[model samples]
Target: MTIVETTSEVEAVVRDTLAVHQSFFLATSGSAGPWVNGAYFAETGLFTLSLVLEQRGRSLAAIRDNPVVSVIISTGSPTEPFLQAQATARIVEDAEADEVRRVLLAKVPQVEPFLGTPVAAVELRVLSWRATDIPNGWLPGRDLYDTSIPVAREHRG
Candidate 1:
C-alpha cells in the first residue's frame, strides 16, 4: 500500500521535526553521484521552505546540475535518532522566491544579510512522513497532533 500521509499528518510531523532542530542535511547530486550539505531551514508552511546558505558553491552547483534534492531533518536525541522527518526539495523559481523569503524571515533573524550573497532558496513539498514513539506511541501522527510551537521557555535569546 502507498502510505502517503494526509496533509494534516504530514504537517504535524513536519512542524514537530522543524521545532526540534534548527538545521537539516540537504542531499543533492552531480556528475560525481551524491552530496550533502547542512543549513538552518525555515519551514514557512506545508509547501514552503527556506534555508540559510553560508556559501552557495556546492549546493548551487548541484542544483544547476539537477533540480532534485532531499532534505533530512532529524531529532538528534540519542534516545531515538532514527526518527527523522524528511522533505523533498524543489528549487523555487525567481518569481516566487520573495514570497518564500517573506514567510521564512518572519521567524528567522538576520536573513537580509544572507540575501546579500548569491544564495539559493529551496522549496520543499512534504510528500510523506513517519514520527517515532512519544512516551506511549503518541507521535504527532496520532491523536495528539498539535501544530502549536511556542517559543522555547529556556531560549536565551
Candidate 2:
C-alpha cells in the first residue's frame, strides 16, 4: 500500500470515508463531565458535519456547555481503520436549519419525524483529522482545511 502523504490524498481518504459511512461517534464534555454517543451525520463539503440531535440529550447538553468535540467515523469492521476528527459544534437555526434537515434527511430519511419537536440541528466545523491506519503508519492529525500540500492531478488528453 502506498503511503498517503499529500493534502489531496488526505482529502481523498476523508471524502471516501464519509461517503461510505452514515453514522459516527461524538465525544463531548460539560459540567456533568464527559460523554460519548453515536449519531447519524451528513457532510457538507469536506469540513462540516451535520446532525439532528435531541435537545434534551446528554450530547446536546454537553455541546451547550462546551462546543468542542471529537468525532469518529468508522467502517464498523474490526479490521478496517477509522477516521477521527476534532471539531467545533454549534446549533443550527433559521434558514440553516432547513438546509441541515434537507441534507440529513437525504442521508437518513427515517429522521423526519424527529425534526422539530425535541430535536434540533447541530453543525460540527472540523478543526483537524487523522486516520487510525495509513499505508506507512498512522496518519497524524492535520488542519481540516489545509491546502498547502500539492496534489497530483490527472490531465485528460
Query: What lDDT would each prediction earn against the true structure?
Result: 0.57, 0.78
lDDT of 2 by residue, 1-157 (tens): 3434555666777888888888999999988999999988999868789898888999999999999999999866535657887788999898998898999989888777777578878999876567555543545443334343222012101
Residue 43 shift from truth in candidate 2, angstroms: 0.3
Per residue, candidate 1 scores C-alpha lDDT tens digits across 4-108 of 354455456556666666667778787667888877667766434676454456776776677667766666553442234344456675767776666567666
RMSD of each: 10.1, 6.7
Give the Å error, residue 47, model 2.
Answer: 0.5
lDDT of 1: 0.57
Residue pairs with backbone atoms closer than 3 Å in model 1 (clashes): none
Model 1 weakest 10-residue run by lDDT = 148-157
| Deviation from native of the Cα of residue 26 in model 1, angstroms | 0.9
User: Which TM-score value belongs to model 2?
Assistant: 0.81
Clashes per model (N, Cα, C within 3 A)? 0, 0
TM-score of each: 0.63, 0.81
